[model samples]
Target chain A: MSSALRIAAVAALLSLAAAPAAQAHRAWLLPGSTVLSGAEPWVTVDGAISNTLFYADHQPMRLDGLKAIGPDGTEVPLQNASTGKYRSTFDVKLAQPGTYKIVTATDMTMASYKIGGETKRWRGAAADVATAIPKDATDVQVSRNVRRIETFVTSGAPSTGALKPTGKGLELEPITHPNDLVASEKGRFRLLLDGKPAAGVEVEVVLGGVRYRAKGPELKIMTGGDGVFEVAWPEAGMYWIEAGVRGAPNGSAPAQNAAYIATVEVLPD
Target chain B: MRILKFSGLALAASGAAASPTVGQAADLTVSVEIPKLNVAEYHRPYVALWIEKPDQTAVRTLAVWYDTKLKANEGATWLKDMRTWWRRAGRSLNLPADGVSGPTKAPGRHVVSFSGGQLAGLAPGDYALSVEAAREVGGREVLRVPFSWPPRGAKTATATGSTELGAVSVTVKP
Candidate 1:
């Protein structure tokens, strides 16, 4: 093969090797400490999309969609938020003595349509579809993407006031308080989709520190009929849980794909 | 009608008086030992004692020893250092709890006794007494002693910790 063709062939092989790793990149928000005591204790959190859990070696997770819900259910602003090359770091001053929910949710609409004899793609919010896609376009296919990444931090006592679900996308209704997890004890939670129980969904649970182990100790669990699932932690550390579901297209509405990811800390008994 | 009402009131009063002494009272005594270390800077460890069911759910908190006298209750700040108890029960408890919270103790064996009246609502079952201690600039340790409720007989269970805590024991008497 010619030099240019040989280079193209090698690039194709390299891209093939990198495809799976890119698809496996997990996004997480890791707090320095999940449970805290004291008056107005501050917690630092790092956001990243990386292959190794909790370790920021890949692309930084953007903070534009990040929000912190205070103990009072009010939106609290993140302090000293900065986005570095590999991660995003922010601080939260827990003035209230209850649990706070930090979340980053992104919603987008992906569309592919044929213009004359050519195909074009557009990605944006659902509201922009009318203007972004011409009326003459044919064979238009649209899909909605919703991703929610979250973690909890408690200052003093943990409370559930901030844990109420938004009735949109995939969310966790924690029967077992997230910050109160202990090793060897069962942690119970319910999954919800669009304000209703999301039953029979597959949930993935993996403890952090995957870099030290030869194999990723990932646990697969299915939500029961009532959408509740129990996880008996093998040991104490940070754990990442993810669940996703796809909705069938209905009438004129686009097919929806939603995913919920949470990072929880489990203490040794 | 007056006579019937009077008799009914009298019967209810007698029934209330008879309940406390109905059965054998269950008394529990826990002894916690805070080991003295040779470190240059030593601070009395904050300790917490609580009862948990076989499923590890905290039934009741027996005692919490910490620096309760700090101005503005600032000493409660480090209460999370006793992490296990804090997550299990302490976080939910209001500090300065009557009869349950006290000041930190010096290095030595401290024994606390709970009468049947204090343990009144605890159901009859197998339970464990968990003792956790954390010190400033020092380590933390937890020791659990298992025992059954409404003692079958005079029973004593003990556990030892290498650092931050010494020998801990729980005693139950019928």
Candidate 2:
């Protein structure tokens, strides 16, 4: 084969490998300490997208979509925010004496279509869909992806003011305060999709230190009829939870797929 | 305090008379020991004591020892340090709950007594007493002692801590 053709073939294979499947690469935000006790303590958080939980061996999760919701349900700025090759680091000053929600959300649409016998793909925000594809494009397929990653850090007593569901995409309505989890007790949480109970959804609970263990300790739980699920922590450590669902396509709109991920720390009793 | 105690007894006597099924009233005494450590700084630990069913549902919060005197109720901010109690019962309670909330204590054995009125309405079943302590610039420890409610006889259960706490004992008198 010609060297140029060989190079083109290799590039094609690399692009195929780069296309990640749903749940292939996991994104997480791990806080240095979920529970704090000072008058005004600062909590550092690391963000990454890796195959292993909490391990920043892969790509960095961009901080552009990151936000910290203070105890008052208002937006708080992240300090010392920096993105390196493998991870993103930021600090949150706990000026308020309550729990804060650190979150990152991405909503986008991807479309593939054939124009004049050539297949092409375009990805951008949902509003750009009209301009992304040509008017004469045939066999056009489009889909929407919405992902949210979040964690909680408490400066003093954990308050629920910042934990109210936004009635947006998938979210966790914590029945048990996230920062107050202990190994000896069970933690309860509710799943909401667009502000409604997301029942009968499968939740993936994985312990964070999977790189050290021979087999990953992952627990599969299904949300009850009330969109509630209970997790009886096996030990004290960090845990990653994820749940996703896909909606059926409406008349002209693409199907919307939503995913939610959270990193929670559980203390030993 | 004496008048309050006398009125409490009067109320209990009247309530018991109104309901024969209300068995003999039982009193619970919890002694929590906050150990002293040789360190550069020593801050009194925030402690919480509560009763839980076998399923770990908090039935009643006996006491919450914290910095109740901070300006503008700032001390209540650190109450999450006692994490288990905060999730189970502390978050719902208003601070300085009459007899349930108080200031932090020094390093020593502090005894807290709860009358039948305090532990009233607990169905006869297996229960556990949990004492959790957290210290600033230090560590956290939680100790639990299992016991049954509506004591068939006088019972005593104890737990020991290593870092943030010392010996903790719960006794019930029939």
Candidate 3:
């Protein structure tokens, strides 16, 4: 009987250690920074995970008691369900008219892939933690959401000082809706330079830590003789625009020599 | 057994003495710039730079743009976008970089340089230097520049890139 009790005590200790620790669930609370209208909104769930203990895409994990706190400090309950992986979706009703905060949790592991045949490890806890969602959300900030960017391009022979280091160059504009974003719509930008029409100049629009590249023609625009052009917004979010010719001497490679402008902010209407 | 152990130690010491110290410790000035847009302004880009060998093997991580200013953990998610630098150097890092942090650079001309003494332990050989930039909402471009170091003396090479960088110049001095 004494031996039996000893065995039971050891087993209990083992179970305690194996059980999830207090902060092990620190990464779970999902944060939804973006929500689009006219479609189901998916809240993004992400956090730093330790590959040493947990595994990726661990299912059977669920987040309960989700609520959004408005900028005025009002608690708004959100309806949600885990779709799979590191994502969750909710109906549009949960998104209030103002900025909000989201709190939830998930159990996932961090894993590292071999780069050039080396195995690296990411160290962190396995349990989910609660994270707040910011009110001012962008497409990139939302999990699995995409934004649209539109531009108008025009092309014409450079006049005396046009296209020179100092000249009246181009104008890129961004349009967004209060609605959410779509993935395929990301990475689209526009270009317009000189007084004559400069159509089809290669332009790139980058945002939310992702890059989307497309030719000016695909962006759709009609150029006037005055070098004024336009394209539709392919993605929505805060964005930075760059427009230039592919073949230039600024860098050894033509792609390397292309010049870039400045960053721009696009807010949804 | 003792005799064999002694022989092994002797060989190791001799090999160590004969090895040339070529990984010179060097300092590099780094900068990043993302083009501007009017449609939807993009946030600053998150850029990473590192040194690698000719075969595309990683030697060291020079910089990374990971921080809280952008969003909660957005910097960590985008680390993979800087593919060249990530594969060559970043994937091997055990922790966030110690010195480099923050969002992308504004649109402007920027410059970075390195020296020979900074590469204190490298071997003298033909080396290819590569710099890669990736913008959050912008495209990615990798610029490769080749340089060779003779055991002694300071050698320099300059390489430039397009897109996200107004200009990326590298100066190496012994």
Candidate 2 residue B155 C-alpha distance from true site, Å: 8.8
lDDT of 3 by residue, A120-236 (tens): 323233221112222232221111101111111111100111111112334432222112223333323233343233466655444432323332212323434443333345454
lDDT string for model 2 (B1-174, tens) is 454455456645553222222443677889999998998988999999999987888998878889988887778768877877877787666676666778999999999877656666667888999999989998888898988887778899999998998999989878
The order of the candidates by lDDT, greatest first, is 1, 2, 3
Question: Which 10 residues in a row give candidate 1 chain B its minimum summed lDDT?
Answer: B15-24
Residue-level error in angstroms, candidate 3, position A209: 23
Among incorrect, acceptable, medium and high, the docking class of model 1 is medium
Evaluate model 1: give its TM-score. 0.81
| Residue B162 shift from truth in candidate 3, angstroms | 3.4
Clashing residue pairs in candidate 1 (N, C-alpha, C atoms within 3 angstroms): none
lDDT of 3: 0.40
B1-174 in candidate 1: lDDT tens per residue? Answer: 454344434533342222233343558899998887899999999999999988778988888999999987788888998988998898888787666789999989899987534565567799999999999998899888999987889899999999988999999997
lDDT of 3 by residue, B1-174 (tens): 454344435533342222222343333444434445443746566666666778767665555655445344435545645655654455445334334344455666555444332343445666666666666667777776555653244544555565665445554554
Off by over 4 Å in 3: A1-269, B1-39, B68-74, B113-118, B150-156
Q: Taking the tens digit of each residue's C-alpha lDDT, what string does model 1 give over A65-184?
A: 799999999999999999999999999999889999999988888777889998787889999987999999998877788889999999987899999999989999999999888897
